[model samples]
Target: MCTACLIENVKSHMLSRRSLFSGAAATAAMGVAAGALSARPVLAQAKGRVVDLTHAYDSDFPTFDGKPGILYEVDKNFDPDGYHLFKLTIFEHTGTHIDAPLHFAEGGTSVDALPVENLIAPLCIVDISARAAEDPNAVVEPADIEAWVSANGEIPAGACVAMNSGWTARIGNPAWRNLPDGTLAFPGFSKAATDLLAQTGAASIGVDTLSLDPGNSPDFAVHYSWLPSGRFGIEGLANLEQLPASGATIFIGAPKHRGGTGGPARILAMH
Candidate 1:
């Protein structure tokens, strides 16, 4: 422990510390670079106008069942608490919502368990509005998918194939949910069309209507087949008309409640 010996030891310790810190800093910088690369596509997509595809619904929003989908009770008043809030009693399948596989299958993924990658996807809007305008029960048939592919290129893998039935325009009207005879009538996906979507490796199906199948449908064929097969569906989507037939990407902000069969979602579209 002479002075020179001690000084040399201290110098060695300082050099080791510098090396460690340099290595740590390099690792951190590499992590940031990787993160930026992964985020590029989403950030680039945001350059265009973002369209909200969700419908802001309330207790009165139309549902597959004719009951109220949500109920509200004031929990706090602004004058008294300096804030206002309402306790919400919400039904999972109400509003612009997602239908998880568990909605039908015996053993399936719940809303909280839906894959993160599947939630954001390329959007393919099949415009069946002309047919829907003529027939309330008109469905997006297999032919429509064919036409979509004819006009656009292939439906991207893991894309969300949505049926734009012009039905969102009817939301405020009784006809949106039912016909004059009290029978449910609205446009949706035919089983054959969904089968086509599945063949194309699509991840999800969507409808501007209340159900995946036509309102007058007696059998939930699409629901039974599609959900059990591991794909999900979105119902009550809005602003579908604002999107193009292809190229737009949809971001589904699904609810992550445990064991949720489905739940209200904030869906958006970006080019």
Candidate 2:
């Protein structure tokens, strides 16, 4: 039997299922409860993975205000009475962010307009850490994905593919930010891979870097290839090493900034 069927049978016996029909029903029930199967027994038995693909939000964290970086501010509210209150002033593309189609493409869906079903999906983590270490401007190409499939089988549809470049481990380091000509350097996806993913109709693409294109890119072809196709992109992801290549669901808890182009997001991957 297939691995899934075997897993179901094991789960059935563990749950004390007495018949084949009950086994099928148990599998269906387990699928429905997958998102919330973090109780003590399940956690102990299953030990599924959890990857936190969110930046640490703080007052002094670097955020994209307009050009490059901005920090948040706080205030003590004087609403006719002294009280402690706070405020945040950051750009839509700040920190770990989700790029709604409208971010780069005209007449595209905004964050709110995205379908609810698209909010959560499986994950495909491509390890390009070594290549990115050698060349900071390394771009993940279509051949990379093909090779991954050749080794790891097909990348499932409706999955959130995260390119692990280990860039998040270098966020605000000045030495790494400066290039030879006094410019920032980072890695992202090539237009070829972006186009291939768009053709595959993935719900979204993510990267563990500041942007989905090389830092010095002028045209942003990756955006052009994917955004216009109604697929979104997430940038500045963290903790990609904690996830497996596939079979994990991601939940993006982004603020519903109405009429906003893009915004910071809290992403959690559960396997």
Candidate 3:
């Protein structure tokens, strides 16, 4: 099925569940009005706690293949111009960002075309940090997804699966890229794992590393396997260690660039 169809199916299922809950609430309210039960105490709504999952972009931020990182210039300063204004020159894919399907898939959805619902969804973290520590080239495999399912049920449809390989801890260091041998060596998703997640109806797959595919991959098979389905990718994420394996909802605030293959984003997780 096309990406639009997959998203529509997910929306349909969510609406049905919401309707069921709304109906039950309405019945309870009626019972209360009729005095069938004692008056219940009104509970206050809980405030959501949000965690930043994006890295702050700066000149020091790492980039792939020695690409220019970030450039900031003061166009106007308060002392001289009565306004503190600046111009930022940044690559769309710099720092923490969203990789629209068009980044890898020809004729796929651009960053601006992604639906709002798809930008916010249940967050799932698959941690391969221990393994990554042992081998910088370790990849998250299909068996890892199966293990996650075995322990915590199936991943919900339209969820964003983030691979936490603990690489975020090395963000500013040379280890983030690991190019000693002229090949990047950080951990990422294998093609099998990407295929499994796509099959499970994942809306997006993310990583704390620079790319969703491992550093040494020349074909970027994992990106091809997922993005062509109209899904997205998030990379260079920070603070994955602060989030739980499940239950958090992610809000991806990506720049709306028309015809953009990808763009920077402010990713947040609310629990």
Write down the lDDT of every candidate, Cα atoms only.
0.90, 0.76, 0.86
Q: Which sections of candidate 3 miss by over 4 Å?
A: 1-47
Question: Tens-digit lDDT track for model 1 on 1-271?
Answer: 9999999999999999999999999999999989878655444445477899999988888877789999999999999999999999998999999999999998899999999988988888999999889999999889999999999989888889999999878878988899988899998899999988899999999999999999888999999999999999999999899887877889999999999999999999888
lDDT of 1 at 131: 85
lDDT of 1: 0.90
2 or 3: which has the higher lDDT? 3
**lDDT (Cα, tens digit) per residue for candidate 2, span 124-219:** 788898998888888889988887788867766676788998777776664234466767678889998877876665788898877888777788
What residue runs in model 2 are displaced by over 4 Å at the alpha carbon? Answer: 1-47, 58-73, 77-83
Worst 10 residues of 2 by lDDT: 38-47
C-alpha RMSD of each candidate structure in angstroms: 3.2, 11.2, 14.2
* Residue range with the least summed lDDT across 10 consecutive positions in model 3: 37-46
Mind sharing the TM-score for model 2?
Answer: 0.76
Q: Model 1: which ten-residue window has the lowest total lDDT? A: 38-47
